[model samples]
Target: MPLHKVININSSTTIFLWKITESFEDLFDEVQLKDINLIRLNTMKSELHQRGFLSVRKLLSHCGYTDFDLIYDQSGKPYLEDGKHISISHSHEFSTIVLSDQNIGIDLELVKEKVLRIAPRFMDISHLDNLSEQDQMKKATIIWGIKEAVFKLKNEVGISFTDHIFEDPFLLSDKKGTAKLRFNEGVEQFTIVFEEIENYMLVCALKDE
Candidate 1:
């Protein structure tokens, strides 16, 4: 019942976030999962993951859908039976989903100093220059979320975060930017938006038409 936030990105897109605070039994009793998901849920070894999975179902209900109306591709990307695009993400105590009429991707990540340590692996570290350590961690986490969102949007084989995706330079205060995917002998662009949610960063990528 901890429906944390609902963001109306546009007329056709919205994001829902849930702060996981319910016990496993409480969530399990509330969400009616499909047989496959039930089996899959039972197989999760981590209780946090189980809670995250169940929390997503709570978000689905908020959007007027159910487990029965959702399906996943061979790549494990989730989609809506009504043909609306959907993307999901969770980390630690939070879970989020973005439902849009257009192809879109979203990511939720906890801000941590660890991301600053791995910044070079997936982003242009120059973007982090001139910022204090705290700001750097926040910006790095946002960049990581940008790459993850783009990856979910692409959902292709052989896409390396470091080798394939590139985020353009933007101020952390801007809260939105652009990125490019250079792969398969073609270039595609995406509009990126992000916001700070408590101690976590929430990012969304919308494929350019």
Candidate 2:
């Protein structure tokens, strides 16, 4: 599929989403992968994961970048050669990338009832009260994405989503919220914005400045 959407979060930040509808062979033939990445792709055990990985390269190409322009740190966080901060995420059929002058993280997740079942393990369950079953799942997914995004932004060791991250109360109608990470003997706040795309929830997080 072509580019699904582009979200300009601010003058300096943007999000690009791609809905994967092509075959692995097609995507594989289209992208120019670095040698190491080519080996990595061939070693992937799942075809779905391989497709997701290539779809991200497609998105990079859309943004005037290639696999050669991307690199990962020892912590596994991705970086662009041009000095722009970037975050990448993909779930099922959707993949997304966020670019900003400041550090940022983005998450794309499929909405599933399983999140509600395990909410207590990672988030405050009370926030799900008084909401319908569907909204409960949606909210839990958003909160999970928030934690993942913050973790990606920090890229630090010893951060536990259940123990160190907390989300403030926010209604589903708000489409945005705030969270905090109490780690490394200090507390840092983050601003998050989320939207529903098809059956997935896409969330982007950045440190509060």
Candidate 3:
């Protein structure tokens, strides 16, 4: 499955992972080509599996974050040097990272048939029944991304996606909505936004706590 190419919103902090639709390799200067080393490439491949991480780095530079002051924490969780809350996610053909003053999580998924194969694993029975035939594939992808984002936000809180499924009904409308994500502890609320980008779907979760 592939993501449709479209910019959804004006995120104060966002990094869209373009599918390298055409290998804009020509966009780079000769100097950049010379700097490519096997070691650097391997690190990114391991961290992001050779998807769109290089583009993410380019966007980060454009966003004025040149420090590259990020590191994996003791729990193997990734964080930033300036103490800014951070979240990173990459799947299949795309990868995106978001840095924000507030805790944030983002996920992008290709809206396709593969979701049907794995639908039972992540989505509960009720969610599947709620989908309409017209955009069921697109709607299904949204739920997956939403749960992934919620898990990223609460990983520190020690909850898994299976138990802490989003309580609010899945809203696949173009507009955004708020939802409750919880497992055992008090409910943790998040603002959920679903955006249709090309053929892919993205769901972002920003926690207010």
Candidate 4:
């Protein structure tokens, strides 16, 4: 019931976010899950993860769907029975889903200092130049979300964040930018939109036409 935010990205696309404040039992009692997801949920050792999983179902309900309408490919990408594109992400107390008529990806990440330390492993360090340490962490977190969003959008093997996905340089104030995925002798572009949600960064990538 803690629907934190809803973003109408366009007439055909929307993003839903939930702030997890319910007990696992409460969430479990509220949402109905398919047999496969029920088994998968029981296998999750962490209650936090279980809550995140259940919370996604709750978000689906808001969009007028259920676990029955959601399907996952062998590559672990999610799809809707109605044939709309779907992407999901969860971080700490937050979970998000982007539903669109076009191919899209969404990611929610906590703005942690650790992302700055690992910046070199996943992003172009030059993008972090001329920024304070605080800004660096925020920017790095956004870039990480950018790569994750792109990966989810591609949902292909051998797409390395550091090696294949590239985010265009942009200031944090921009709130939106672009990225490219170069792999398998082809290049694809995506428009990236992001926002800071409390202590988390929420990013969504829509494939360029």
lDDT of 4 by residue, 1-209 (tens): 57889998889999999999999999999999999999999999999999999999999998899999999999899999999999999987999999999999999999988898899999889999999998899999999999999999999999999999999989899999999999999999999999999989999999999
The per-model lDDT (C-alpha) reads 0.94, 0.95, 0.62, 0.94
- lDDT string for model 3 (84-182, tens) is 766766565565666667777788787888887776777764766756764777767887788888877767666656666663665566547666776
Per-candidate TM-score against the hidden true structure: 0.98, 0.99, 0.74, 0.98
lDDT of 2: 0.95
* C-alpha lDDT (0 to 100) for residue 142 of candidate 4: 95
What number of clashing residue pairs does each candidate have, in the order they appear?
0, 0, 3, 0
* Ten-residue stretch with the least lDDT total in model 1: 1-10
* Residue 119 displacement (Å), model 2: 0.9
Residues 129-161 of candidate 1: C-alpha lDDT, one tens digit per residue: 999999999999998999999999989999989
Q: Which digits, one per residue and each the tens of the lDDT, describe model 2 over residues 30-97?
A: 99999999999999999989999999999999999999999999999999999999999999999999
Model 3: pairs clashing at backbone N, Cα or C within 3 Å: 4-198, 4-199, 4-200
Q: Rate residue 49 of model 2 by lDDT.
A: 91
- Tell how far residue 91 is off in model 2, in angstroms: 0.5
Off by over 4 Å in 2: none
